[model samples]
Target: MSERHVTFDMIVQAVGAVAGITHHEIMVAGRAGADERVHLRYACWWLASKMTSLGPSAVGRLSGGRDHTMVIHGQRRAEELRATSESFRLSTDALLGTLQALERAGLLRFAVTIDPLATARRVLSAPEREAVRVSTYEIVAMSRLIVEQADGDPSEPSTEETAHAA
Candidate 1:
């Protein structure tokens, strides 16, 4: 598949769409513990760092002007979560898949290949393959939710609770 240049904004937007969260929520300055907003922010940082040529520092700047250390920490945490948490891994993998599908369909301005496992492994200190519990139905549902949100569907799940659920 042909790869396309995916912008930071595009990555943030797509991830936000799949996660049922918003860019504002992610970029908002805060040290909110391990909440959904924080999770989304970290996921955004990890995705941006991988999907683009931007370094940790640039990713930090885009993500609320966070310091490189903070970006690094977030990336490390994301890697840890991806390796240890099945739900977290599925959520992240699903978002990446959604972005890839969007790119391939030309719904996005560019086309990009996103290999979640490979990307995560690239950042992981110790990578291990775990059986994925996510079914095709769940992935399709996540994709549908993302598409609806992107289309500005009024019925889209945008509530904080719904966003947290993803």
Candidate 2:
């Protein structure tokens, strides 16, 4: 099996796709008013925690700048739902299975080393960390723009072409 670094963004996108919600809805800060939205967000957290090498804080950072405690709570809620709800378990399991399939197909990637302190080592200062976080958001936004411009067709011109034409 080929290894790929499955990013936190990938998990969020996958969860959003599976749940029929936008990634924006999942990543938006604040308490989601809808139970479905809350549960989907929790599922994203649980999946990211389980699937990636990122720590809770890193996962939280990638997930709408949430606190580690909030990530932990979401994880716990997800686990509780999985234990008690067969439908929830089946859905999550299906999502997990889809990700696993992608991994096996060499489409999805995962971290190489499972370093516990990786998050700490990645950012030396709070300002640096925030910068990195902002960059991530920008990257995601750019990706969305590119995808939107592509419009499900690979033969389409690139983003630059579209921009230049405008």
Candidate 3:
């Protein structure tokens, strides 16, 4: 396999890790097509475009075969959000930190400013951190429910199961 392929994979992993979603979710637009998902997708495109030799069209192709216009629009929107929204800026910074961590771990060859710890500390105030934690928990719980439903296992845990669960 080519180094580029590996780098692309790393990029995808980094995005998923920072966004708190699975790689599958990153690839799929999702049922709700929520703004959060769209933003993350845009972030993916922006990061790939910035870091790789690939043009907008190529980056678009990599990100769910989106058109070049979509790539341009998404990147532009993300850039605008970063300029205007503090939370969005922090989130993007956090993502950059993850990418940098990937680079440090030798999962990626490119150089990125890895300051996720510091940036997280600086950006996420106490209440914000708690919110993020709660949000993550909720997302995980919801994802689990979705998976169980998809598998045709909608039965709730019985008292016996709960009793032995702990």
The prediction achieving the highest lDDT against the true structure is 2
lDDT of 1 by residue, 1-166 (tens): 4355666667787777876766665666556533877777778877776666778887776665689999899888999989998998898888777766776677765333233333334436444645444445345434543453363443455577587998
Candidates sorted on lDDT, descending: 2, 1, 3
Q: In candidate 1, residue 119 scores what lDDT?
A: 39
- Every model's TM-score: 0.58, 0.64, 0.55
lDDT of 3 at 34: 72
lDDT values, one for every candidate: 0.67, 0.69, 0.62
* Model 1 CA lDDT for position 59: 75
Could you tell me how far off, in angstroms, the CA of residue 149 lies in candidate 2 after the best superposition?
19
- Higher-TM-score candidate of 1 and 3: 1
lDDT of 1 at 52: 67
The true-versus-predicted C-alpha distance at residue 92 of model 3, in Å, is 1.5
Question: lDDT score, residue 103, model 3?
Answer: 53
The digit string of per-residue lDDT tens for model 3 on 1-166 reads: 1233224445666777877776557666656767878877777777776555577887665565689899899889989988998988887778767665655566754333222233345445675454443334334434543553353233456566689998
